[model samples]
Target: MYENTVPFKIHSDYTPTGDQPQAIEGLIEGLNAGMRGQTLLGVTGSGKTFTMANIIEKTQRPTLVIAPNKTLAAQLAAEFKAFFPENAVEFFVSYYDYYQPEAYIASTDTYIEKDCDINDEIDRMRHSATSALLERRDVIVVASVSCIYGLGDPSDYKDLMINLRQGMICSRDAVIRKLIDLQYVRNDFEITRGAFRVKGDTLDIFPPSSEELLTRVTFFGDEIEKITEVHYISGKVMWNRNYAVIFPASHYATTKEKLDRALVTIEEELEERLAELREQGKLIEAYRLEQKTRYDLEMLSETGFVKGIENYSRHLTRRKPGEPPYTLMDFMPDDYLLMIDESHVTVPQIGAMYN
Candidate 1:
């Protein structure tokens, strides 16, 4: 675990007024006394966020603030960033602007395929949040209920991260291969996020977490020679770095070994499902399931992926049936504080999600 040396500092012009001071003091006192939960009931005009900021500054802990929706999450994130200008304030929410979930309607005999359009900018912010949590200490993430949804295992994500340093003995081809394993695409003509281009001994990579800055790694034979940051549009070298860390492009990163094992398990499940349907005298259902499962299996075998891959996530993660999927919470430090904004609505919604 990386220890954060910098303490959380609030950069605010206005001091806590009205009931804010008491609320902040009570929250801090409760936290210091090892209280499990505390509530701050305030009217709409009250400066709840400011009080929370004061408590955060006093506690000096990493924080995760959950909002009921994307709008509120974005608002909270903006406010936190303003409050703690020196700290890392990240926004995390579903990247999709619109989503149509995969569903099977037996009565209507209809199957809806999954469809979604990802917001590239939001995806970058999501990556920024995860990376900050792993690499820094003075971090605050404001997220929607999407935080409860599945994400790649943090351990696997950390394992796939590639750290490069100047003067390291490593092959250019090897580094490119590792990037490919982490789901990065190679595009020499078009430079974009999650893409890399090789120009002779130099590899320019645009990480998913960044929008404007691109990393340039120059290799000397089989050894790393230099690393620098370059502006994406201007192509100007901004600064040189001795080391850089590259995280995976996608959240659902998996190893080839895990994919192979998951394929076998998927096949076994398909067989059992087909058998059960046939025994129940539903031959049509059995045929439908068999064809669908086999098509998905073939796609998985050939391309190492399939549409709606999350359906087989249990197998990919090697989790038991009915076990909860790993979420963003798994990426947080052990002693991090969780603040649920608008808890009156957010708390019940979270309970409904589980039920």
Candidate 2:
């Protein structure tokens, strides 16, 4: 529904001054000359973000600005949102408010399982970021080092999306199935984010990327008769449209065939690993790995997902061994811009994550 193309225009009361003008011009010139990387050295309060915004507007290319941490990323995203009010300015960071990595201590013979609590709001914002990238070019995503981490395949995400247009030949039952396949819950009693409800010929869908509106589609027999945005609570129509697009409820979008293929590959990889472990005479470790892998496989077969399915992302997306995982940057076009904030610090942080 929100695939309208537009130019980025900064709605700011302040104007560029000091080195700001030179920095902006130099950056634009470098981009025009096909420079892959360019830095704008500036101290605190030097309006570097504003300068970057100007560069983005001039270049007219989608930009991803990475900060070293979530706080800084949030600040940059807010400023960018203020500047480009009409465009998509998304904040993306690790959704976990608290995270503890899984570990095993040989000395103490202790196994500390992985544990973390994800912030729902942050998760929603992350979905918003990916959705914006897929739908439009006028997007500015301010992300932390977590941006380097795997975010699933964007092609699969865009391909599996539910695109409903008025007068299309789609049955209400088919729409329900599409939502469920996209991981949307059917909450008939109350409409919540990532949920859908049906009543008679109308279907209400609350997309994960949308915060304030739900899409209401009316069906006349097997044809989509109406599509519109409605307030989530009041159910008042906000906007009428001839088209609507519903992204996956989560990033890891896979069809049944793809999942089955991934499962087989995962089993093969597990066997290979187990052979090495057995050859090394690590029998206890080998048994533990086999048991765990089988348990995960069973869960995936029944529920279509597991808690740490991302660990087997290579299998799921069918990528080569040691290949860099698909990150948020992969969602953007090859010509899209990357602006690293506080490069001296953030650059090293990115390296740490990569390592």
Report the number of the highest-lDDT candidate: 1
Q: Which parts of model 1 are misplaced by more than 4 Å?
A: 1-5, 104-111, 299-303
Candidate 2 accuracy as TM-score: 0.93
In model 2, which runs have C-alpha deviations exceeding 4 angstroms? 103-113, 279-281
lDDT per residue (tens digit) for residues 292-336 in model 1: 888988977775667777778888888988999989999999999
Q: What are the clashing pairs of model 1?
A: none
What's the count of clashing pairs in each model shown? 0, 0
Each model's TM-score, in the order given?
A: 0.93, 0.93
What's the distance in Å from true for residue 355, model 1? 1.5
